[model samples]
Target: MMKMKRIALSALLSLGLTACGPMEESEPMPESMFEEQGSQALDAACTSLGTGITSHACVHSGNPADHLARTASATRVTSAPSISTKHTAYDIALPSGAEGSVTYVPATTGSYAFYRTQNVPFTVINGSTSATVPSALSQTVSSSGCLLVYVSVHDLTAGTTYIVATGPASGNAITVVPEFLDDSRTRYYRDADGDGYGSTTSIYTACTPPAGYTTQRFDCNDTVGSGASINPGATEVCGNGIDDNCDGSQC
Candidate 1:
C-alpha cells in the first residue's frame, strides 16, 4: 500500500480521500489471478455488480491491495462531513477507497449528478436516507464490535465515473447511473456471514443491514449465493454494503 500526503484541497475534501500508492499493475494479472489468490474464498461469495465488471466498490485506506466492489455498476460511500463548495472536486481517485456501506446523509437528498468511467447494468439508489451514527467511535459497533460505516453527500468521490441522480434528498426520484463512473468501494474485507464487514455489533451491532442480509460473504468469485458472491441472489440487507442483490456490485 502506498501512502501519500492529503494536501488538503478545497471544501470538496473527503475523509475517504487519500494519496494511494501505485497499484500492483506489476503482474498485469488476469481476471483469473484472483482465483489463485484467497480471493476465491472472497469470490466464492461475490460476483459482478450492476455498474460493470471493471468497477471497484471497496478499497482500503492503507493499501487496498484487494478490491471487491469491482463488479457492481456503482460504488457505495458515506458523507463524512459537510463539505464546502470550494472543495467539491467530485472527480478524484481514491488510492483504494471503495465503500461497502455508507452513511445515509440527508445532504444527498437533493437532485445530484454522478458520472463514472463506464456503465454497468444495475440500479443506483439512496437507501435509508438518514445517517445513523455521528462519529466513527460513537458509531455503535456491530454484533462483532466493528463500527458502522456512514455515508453522506459529502463522502461521494469525484472523477471515477458514475450515474446521475435527481429527486428529493432521500426520496431520490430519478436515480440513473447513465453508464458513467459509478466506481465507489463495496468489497474490501470478507463478510461471508454478514457479520459486519470486518467486525461489528451483532446483527443489531452493525448498521442497517441490506434489504437481504447474509453472512460469510466474499468478493472473489461471482457465483456463490452469498451477498459477496459474483452471481446474483436473494441479498440480505447486510448493512447496506451496496450488494442489494448480492451480485457483487462491490465484487
Candidate 2:
C-alpha cells in the first residue's frame, strides 16, 4: 500500500500537479507595474491626472478660458503661471510673484479639491462677482521631489463660475486637477446683502451656516439698498416695477 501511494505521488508531480489540488492561476499584474521602469508617479515636468481608460492630459496656454474648456471637457491640463499677470491683484492675498488663473464651473454642488504637482500657492474665487471663496482646508506633501498641494473647497454650486489661481513659483509646467469630494454636510449660500434669501451662485458647505450666509437660495436680486425685501418670504408689492418677491414678474 505504501509503494502504491508513492507511485501515485510521483505520477502527480510528473504531471506538474500539486498533491493538495490542481495548479492555481497566476495573478494579473498591477496597473502601476505596467509603467515603464524608473518612471516617477508624476513626471518632473508636469503631472498627468486620470490618465487611464477614457481620460488624457494636455498643455494649456495661459488663457483662463482655455483652461476652462479643457478641464470642463474632461481633459487634464498642464499650465504655467502667467509672467504678465502674476502680480495682478486677486480677491485674496497672494505671494509676490506671477500667477495664472483658470475658470472652472462645477457640474454639481458639493465639496471639491484641487491637486497640484508643484508646491505653489492657490486660491479660488467667484468668477462672476470676483469674491474670494474660502477653502475648507489645505495640505502639502512631498513626492519624489514633487510637491503635492491639495486644497479642499466646500459648497461649490453647479453652473456657477469659479476661478482657480496657481502661482508665484517658477519651474516647469504644473498639472492641476479638480476632483469632487463626497460628504453629507448641508450646503448654504452667501447672503451678503442681509436678505433672507441667498444667491444660488455662491455656495458653501458646513455643519452650520457660516456668518453672513443662509440656507435659502434663489434671490433674483440680492444686492444691497433694495435686496433686503427681495426674498421668497416677501409679499409681492404688485406693479411697483420690481419683482420684490423674486417670482419673475412685478405683478
Candidate 3:
C-alpha cells in the first residue's frame, strides 16, 4: 500500500521549461571531495533525488569547516533569491541527451556502487539493470549513505539536467517532464541586461519592456523580431526577445 506519486509539473511542462531562479549559486564543491561528511552522508554536485525529483537540495554548504565568511552579505546573493518558481518561454533545451537503465539497491547488502557524469563505463547506460527488488517496488529504497534509483526508460525523454554520483557522495538529479506544454507550448526565460541568468526568448513574439518601466522582469529584446540571436532557425520576432538564452539580444 505505497502507491502515491504526483509531483507533476509534467517534468517541467513537457520541456516548455520554466524556473530561472534558484539553482544558480555555483562554486562550492570541496570538502576534500567528500567520501562522507557529518551533517548527513550525502554530497552535492546534486542527490537523495527521487519521485523523479524537483525538490532536491545541497548547492554549497557541503560543510567546508562551515565557511560562510560570517558577514557583509556573505559576499554575494543580493536580490534574486526569492526563487520558488518562474521561468517561461517553453524552457527549450534538448541535447542534454544520452541516459538509460540505472538501477541500484543495497540497503542491507553492502558494497553497492554507481557511476556516470557523462558516460563511458560501457558507453554509459543503466537501462534495465535491476537487482531484483519487487517487494512492490520498495519505497525506492534509501538510507544512511542514502541512495535510491529506478529507471526503465521509454520515450521517457523530457527536459534535461542530470549529474548525480553516489559512492563517495555527490549531488544533482532533477527529473520530471512526463509530458506537459503550453504558453503556445510552454517555454519562457529572460534576463536581457541583467545577466545573472535566464537569457532566451521568442515563443511567438511581441515584447516591449524598456520605456520608463515601472518594474522589469524583461521585455522585447526580441521574441520574433528576427533580430537574429534567439537561435534555432533565426528570423522571427514580434518582440519578446528571441535570443532565447543564446545570450545575444532579448533586451
Candidate 4:
C-alpha cells in the first residue's frame, strides 16, 4: 500500500518538472525556534545514555547481548540479503538501486532495538502480511567513524523469523545489532527512607535505576524517616513487640 503511494508521487513530480513554466523565487521558511530547542533537548538526552550495549542512546551498543550475541565488534560484519523475496508486499521501494533484506530470528520476545552502522533506512517486517514501523528512531545522532550510530526500536517475537530490510547500502555489507531492551531493565525497589534495604511493595523496572531506588528489598518497615532504623539487618529487640530483623516473629 505504502509502496504504491510513493510510486504515484514520484511519477507526478516527474511530470510537473517537465511541464513547468516560468519559476518564481521560493524562499525557504525559517525553522521554528521551538523545534530547534526540542532538537537540542533530544541531543542532550542521547549524550546522557550510559556506555554499554544496554544503553538506549543512538550510539552503538557494542555486540548484541545474551543469546543474541554473535561475535566481537570487528568481526560482526554481515552481507545484506537481496531485496528479492517471495513476499513482495513487505518490500522496501527505493527510487533507484537495489535494496537488501535479512532474516532476523530473535532469541526472546520483547521490545528489541536495531542499530545500523551505516546511515541507511532500516525496517522490520513481522511477516508477509504486516511490517512494523519503528516506535522510536534516532533523529539527532549520526555515525561516528565506522561505528554503529543510527538506532530504532520495534516489538519482536521470539522464534518467529522476520525480515529486516534496508535501503541500498554503500558496500552491500551492513551490521545491524539487535538488542532486547526488556532484558536490560533491572528491578529496583523504592528506598524512601534512604536505608540500604527496600520494600518489595514499591518497585520499579528500568535500565538505569531511578533516584530513591535500590536493588535491595525486604524492608519490613519502610515508613520514611522512622523506617531508616528498621530493616532486616537491624538487631531484634526481644520485648519491643517489633520484628526488627524481619524474621516474621518477635521474641
Q: Say which candidate scores most in TM-score.
A: 4
Candidate order by TM-score, decreasing, is 4, 2, 3, 1
Give Cα-based local distance difference scores for all models. 0.26, 0.50, 0.24, 0.53
Provide C-alpha RMSD values for all models, in order. 23.5, 23.6, 23.8, 22.1
Looking at model 1, report the run of 10 residues with the lowest lDDT sum: 171-180
The total number of steric clashes, by the backbone 3 Å criterion, in model 2 comes to 2
Query: Residue 110 in candidate 2 has what lDDT?
Result: 55
lDDT of 4: 0.53
Q: Model 1: per-residue lDDT, tens digit, 110-135?
A: 21222222222112333334222221
TM-score of each: 0.16, 0.34, 0.16, 0.47
| Sort by lDDT, top down from the best | 4, 2, 1, 3
For 8-112, candidate 3 gives per-residue lDDT tens digits of 555566555455444555644443443232212111211222221211211111223322221111111222111112121111111133222222121221111
Deviation of model 1 at 74, angstroms: 12
Candidate 3 displacement at residue 53 in angstroms: 8.8
**Model 1 whole-model lDDT (C-alpha atoms):** 0.26
**The best candidate in terms of lDDT:** 4
| Cα distance off (Å), candidate 1, residue 176 | 13
Which segments of candidate 2 are over 4 A away from where they belong? 1-97, 142-147, 183-251
Instruction: Report the poorest 10 consecutive residues by lDDT, candidate 2.
Output: 51-60
